[model samples]
Target: MNRRTVVVGTLVVAGAVLAGGAYLYNANQAEQAVAIANENAAVLIRPNSPIIGPEDARVTIVEFLDPACEACRAFYPVVKSILEESPEDVRLVVRYAPFHDGSEEAVGILEAARAQGLYVPVMEAIFAAQPQWAAHGSPNMDLAWSAAEEVGLDVERARIDMRSPAMVALLNQDLADIEQLQIGQTPTFFINGQPLTEYNFERLDEQVHEALGN
Candidate 1:
């Protein structure tokens, strides 16, 4: 290429890189602002929310999860591993963000399961059968119910409890947090009230360890 042409091309490439870098910086700043504003973990770790592991654990991992979300199902084991690895140091708090069709009903089912003292088993069962019941665009809710039944959840009683005022109130609070936190995706995680910028095992592990001061 000619010298002038090469110089022009280099300038264009340099400009693009600068612009991209600026965008990333701005985005990171905005995310940090949001994280700072929403650091009150108590708003999410309410009495009604599902808790896995020691309630008073030092490291709290809050997950905004949609039952029908494939990503949520995929992350279940990862979160489970974090708890299993350091049961006394880490705990998981789940907040429902059921954006997909029929996923709200699944959340209701989980609430009912909680009432029945079967939340953990039912949740595990649902995740295990997520593909069959949580199919994208055309979920098979019957299969979800069946999975709950297999885990000994009383479907009939659960239906009644799902419609209870208490369940409605809990769901409303979770929805409000979803909006206030500007959560646009399922399985959004926060470790010690700081949001996860990237979703990956290593990043999550790092955050967990950081929270534990390890």
Candidate 2:
């Protein structure tokens, strides 16, 4: 081949090789990102946990939320839908980071529900009927108790457990986790381990695909 033709052929081959290398590097990065996320996101699951979703799921979603936060309440349905749709594949862990004074009481009640193995039911009931009790302007223990009763919890025991040091510690630990993760607001979500700034069904699907090498 003439020099020009040989040079052109070499340039084309080099370009293809470079493009292939770039693709491989990107693929490696996506894999590493997912791995890192999973490692940072693993959290303890309490027995009879109120948290929803599968324990061994491919995607874990951690949410820092406040019981009295209106925005958190608003996001309830969306979270519910995500859980229902991905029951076996998505694990959701809820960490209470009460932004209001009344948040502690609400958090206590939730912790109590965990003790009773009624955590999920109580949380679902509370979110479903949030408009009724959350409007009390503070973490109304009475209202939280009422919601517990509505969810078939042993209201008296729930109330008693809510006052325990263990419950307080649990809430404090949740708060610490939120802080450690640098969560600044209610409804802040971490998917796997990375904070999800633009999370939606589409993005979740895309991330899951990348994670699974699809």
TM-scores for all candidates: the values are 0.83, 0.69
Say which candidate scores most in lDDT: 1
Regions more than 4 Å wrong, model 2? 1-50, 136-139, 199-214
Candidate topping TM-score: 1
lDDT of 1 by residue, 70-133 (tens): 7676667667767878889899999999899889899988989999999989999998898898
In model 1, where is the ten-residue run with the lowest total lDDT?
A: 16-25
* Candidate 1 off by > 4 Å: 1-30, 33-42
For model 2, the local distance difference test gives 0.63
Whole-model lDDT values for every prediction: 0.79, 0.63
